[model samples]
Target chain A: MGVFTIAKTITGNLFSRPPTSRYPAEPAKRFDLTRGHLAFEPENCRVCRVCMLRCPTQAIVVDREKRTWECDHFRCITCGNCVELCPTDALHLEPAYRSPEADRPGKEFHEIPAPPPKAEAGGETAEA
Target chain B: MAYMKRSPWIIHYDGSSCNGCDIEVLACLTPLYDVERFGIINTGNPKHADIFVVTGSVNEQNREVIRNIYEQMPQPKVVAALGICACSGGVFRECYNVMGGMDKVIPVDVYVPGCPVRPEQIIDGVVKALGVLEEKRARMKAGAPAEVPA
Candidate 1:
């Protein structure tokens, strides 16, 4: 009785469709909330340094004076802290993941445009 | 040479890590990722492997072991550092024992950076490693240096 049951199970599995997905041929399904890679739009950033301060790994660096934002891809754990803390909605998590590179990768820096000079009523605008 | 392109056996090793990346590395062997679909075979012995898949960062304790594994693998081999830990020591970089990335110990051919690293990324890294393997083979045939100078 036991042998017959085992045989049935083995045959059942032999003919069943493989659970594996065809990954390269077809892109893998990813969730909207899936944390894969981080993207930054410097133009939208205010250079508040929030993302840099909130990053647990200290992978992000913000230069307010220079209006620059930098993140080390290798050091970043993709923890999403920076993305959540970004005030300007400049940082976001992309569903697509980082691909392998032949050469060792490095940190990327983005330059944000300096804020426009503040307008003064009936007066000249403040120099940036 | 023909078999090298079709079937690239891999030897996986963990240096210093929390094992998050290690689990994801194993996931590639599962049916969901099924790295074997590309004729990849996960092997235990370094002598039989064409690719080295290392998870985690290099630490003082495991430096020798990592080097030994790299040396054991036959020529025309590629190394894929899987995950942020393996690529650059991740959060452990400041640790006294941490020694940075796989590049600190061995020459890394491919770098796949992430926290634990997704199984798909590992598969992608391996596929990229395969391309590097082919290039190395061609270079060896041409009698050029086996590796590009830094």
Candidate 2:
């Protein structure tokens, strides 16, 4: 409101560091529990439909008979409900978000990986 | 292209939502994420906007409003659905008043999927929308019919 205020504002603008984050050019700093995206580890998945049922938006579609799991990216709210409800810890939240692409909606379908086989009698089981 | 490449004004509208994504959309304008560096200007009037950024879902009450806004914009405009709600209605899809995504009312050029949509993701979505805007301009120059989905 005064001439001194204007002079001070000019001096501060000249000396202060810019507050803007240089994202895209530099990596974004996501927090430890940031729910950016969801990951489905088919190897650890037991073809359970818990994630599908637990999803509030019904974004996940699990076909246990066909051993296929699919997620509609656009439809997912990234609420981590599926990740939290996964019994085998097959579904988890990733800190890295999905990059924006062309106008088309994305849906990912992944085949369930086979569970590790048991070792021969009296042998130690392979750890995942 | 030179003019559009330098400045692209945006219009932000909030439909049926919890207002979380709306705050993130506004965050992109703040100094920390400063989307203005890309020459994006947020405007309220749809006629002056080159990009339409929508947050939240399209409900029965707001469908007409969204359609009218999209209709007011000139050709070569892009629409960004800024969160899971705008993209596919989020947790409100099953609500009796909710009709679904922004796409249900108008063509959407980009989708940033998140609960509240991070500022970085919103900026990324806008960048992708800029590409679509270029394509729409080219198509308009070519005199091809704009085959936007109904």
Candidate 3:
């Protein structure tokens, strides 16, 4: 509406960075409680069932008979409740939000990590 | 019609999102899509808008503000609920504080459903909202908006 309004707008835009994010290709700036792929660090996992018990949607599944932990990412709410309640600090939110196989059709993407190579069963894995 | 076709304003609200959809909504307004080229403005004030774009499940803390904001918009407006969260509570349906989707709070005209709907989808939804406005204007001119049966 005013003569100087145009000038003010141009100056304000010059100070701001472009808004699009280049993720996966470049490391993202991390944030607190970032809702990302839930990383299950099995090294420290005690198989306590704490993450399983605290999850709201039952997205976290632990087969006590098999001694395995799983998460169906498509169903996860990313509430960080499991990480908060886990005593082992085994489950936590990762900085990388995008999942691999993002565009694949019909094949369920963002799968719960494959049950750690079963010691009793024969599968492709490392041995202790 | 001419004024609306020239400068369409939208108010984007995040009810109780995890912020994945929030970032994508912001991405649509950025250089990637450059929605501003279409003269679309994302405003914080609801009274100045002809469109409402909502993301996330309507939580207890935000349902009141969301409803009040929808009511404040001038007539002949459209609401495009973005992401699966706003569509039908997406993956957060049963949370203790979540009040389901924004639709449970206000009437939604168009729904763009995705985990976090892509920028192109967001643009398509906005364009659809504009089309709804044009259709409503035609109805008002033809007296079709009045005396309609339930």
Candidate 4:
């Protein structure tokens, strides 16, 4: 009886498809909530620097004067603090990781255009 | 040099990691991930390795050891920094003993950044490293000077 069970198990293993994921040939498994990487929308960014301040790794640098937002991908841990704290909803956590690179790439920089004068007025009114 | 692509042996070193990334690295070797399909074999000797897989952040204690292993590997090699810690010190960057990422000690060819890198990402990083190895070999074959470590 034991021998029959072992044979059945062996045949089951042999007939079943391999469990390994064909990652490169096919896409890797991803879910809706996966914190793969961070994405920034310069137009929506208020340059409040909240993401910069809240980031534990200090991976974000926002220059309000220059209206520039920069993120060092290497330093980012995908912790989502910036995503959660962005008052303007400028930041988002994407579900696909940044591709691997051969050389250390420079920081991701985006020059946010100055907010429209009317939007600035509205923002101040909302704050008040 | 051509054979390096067919079967690239990698040597892994833990600098000061918390072992989260290391576990993911191990997962890549399991049947589920099975990195061996790409001819990747994790080895123990640096001299036999074509790629260096480093996990964790570099600290004062492990810098020299990391350098020694890097020096032992033959030319036309590649280095893959396997996690956020190995890439840029992760959350430990501010620590007094932590000196930043793998590039601080040795030139890194591929940077894979994750708090604890996923097995799929590890395989992706290794594939990227293989591409780098091919480039280095081509450079060597042309008798060009190897890249100077920054």
- Among all candidates shown, the one with the greatest TM-score: 4
Best by lDDT: 4
True contacts kept of each: 0.89, 0.74, 0.07, 0.66
Candidate 3 chain A — worst ten consecutive residues by lDDT sum?
A: A100-109
* Stretches of candidate 3 exceeding 4 Å from the true structure: A1-128, B1-6, B144-150
TM-scores (chain A) of the candidates:
0.79, 0.80, 0.62, 0.88
Candidate 3 lDDT by residue in tens digits, A1-128: 77699889888789877554442234555577556557777656656676766676566776656656677553455678888877657778875453322111211222233445663343212111
Cα-based TM-score, every candidate: 0.89, 0.88, 0.54, 0.92
**Cα lDDT tens digits for candidate 3, B1-150:** 233465679998888888887898888777756677778999988989988988888988898899999999887777888776786675678878887767687877777655676666676677777877777667778877621222
**CAPRI class of candidate 4:** medium
The per-residue C-alpha lDDT of model 3 at residue B78 equals 79
- Tens digit of per-residue lDDT, candidate 1, span B62-146: 9999999999999899999998888888899888989898899899999998888888888889888999999998999999877
Which regions of candidate 2 are displaced past 4 Å?
A: A1-13, A116-128, B1-4, B146-150
Indicate which candidate wins on DockQ: 1
| lDDT (tens digit, per residue) of candidate 2 on A12-71 | 999998888888788997999988899888877876687887788899998866879999
lDDT of 1 by residue, A23-111 (tens): 87789779998888899997777766778776777889888667678888988888888777665678899988888787765778888
Docking class of 1: medium
lDDT of 4 at B17: 97
* TM-score-better candidate, 1 vs 2: 1
How does model 1 score by TM-score?
0.89
Model 2, residue B133: what's the lDDT?
84
